[model samples]
Target: MKLLSEVEPEVKVSVKRIDGGLEVKGNLEELGISEGTELTVVATEPVHVHAGPISLRVAGKETVVARGWADKVYVERGGATVPLLRLEAGEKGTVGTIEGGKVFEDFFALLGIEKGKEIEFLRHLPDDTLVLKIDDHEISMGEGQASKLMAEHGGKNIQVNYLGENEKAKISKIIGGTSLKEKFEQMGVVEGKEITLVRKETPAPSPKRGTYVLAKLGEQLVTIGRGLAEKVWVE
Candidate 1:
């Protein structure tokens, strides 16, 4: 009788019921989580969960994808290149190339990944955490705050979560509306402020489930959210 988000780490729990919309349940099912399914809470401090599905046919390695990161993944099908989100359930394509520079090519290289990034893309973690450095302090934003944040970068307005990795850019503009704007103001994130990417991760494995897309690409298990899974195309 506990919400998945409230469960503690290392405690074994069965999914008695999942309360979400059809798309939420569908995404969970695609990721191999459903009712009557048993899951172990791996780490709750970071809000991370690892459910090793013994029955799942998770072909290869597991690498979590992030949102905003998917826009760069291009799949080759019928001699044409398309984004991963464009494919149907049964359709398949080979991940031919990746754009953005060279920040996240390591994961894609294993699955015939071409090459690629300079930020404007977050790690697209499983839960809804988006971390960034404003000034000398690190800031973590929840899903709602993260999604609502729009910063002026590259001469246009973009999601703060979409800031490029290692790419230092001035906030220039912050469109975090209403309460969201107040949240940023409290944390000292404002227009004309320069933000830098905070990269110090050697992600091992995991995700309890949030807004990610579960993709199986060439023996590699990718759990991407924050709109990033679409960046890594697959066949």
Candidate 2:
């Protein structure tokens, strides 16, 4: 068993284990070594190995591993691996398990990272520049810095319920641009009308507080502040 970093480039080797570490033996381009990379052994007449989920074939006829190393190396496809925290634009790859011990796993978990989660690499590090959307609302995270915001999302359903009176009407004009509040008004929500909170469901730890009622009028739906809604004195 040899650590990928410890092994010399182009040395014949094989993988011996995958838990808590990766073992491989082969004539490899060490310069290409990266965390969470997948690999496979050659079988049948085609003497070669495949790497990554896409199974990019390596060590073809020209570069074959010694049979001794081939039998010892172990590899898995879509097995347990942690995705690395990517900080570049358009840079994408799956995660493999951490090379270190339990401490590494715990620390990564604190960063809201887990195996098998697909993350979009972002370019910046501050001011919500990294774009990630939950439930279709796009939010900006600090550029390349989104990886630090760690939390787990246990699947949960949050249902939004509508209440209060409602007035149905079509929109005739829009008062503003595409802001949520503006769109509501353009949908016939306006002052002096009543609407109910519609149903909404989402996972646990929902960022939204609760549902809202819209006042419908002309071609717009005017959104009233929660405080103002309480004072509406609905009849």
Q: Judging by lDDT against the true structure, name the best candidate.
A: 1
Query: How good is model 1 by TM-score?
Result: 0.33
Candidate 2 contains a number of clashing pairs equal to 42
TM-scores vs. true structure, each candidate: 0.33, 0.20
Show model 1 residue runs off by greater than 4 Å: 1-125, 142-144, 172-176, 200-235
Name the lDDT value of residue 124 in candidate 1. Answer: 29
RMSD of each: 14.4, 27.1
Error of 1 at 170 (Å): 2.3
Worst 10 residues of 2 by lDDT: 47-56
Off by over 4 Å in 2: 1-88, 124-235
**CA shift of 64, model 2, Å:** 39
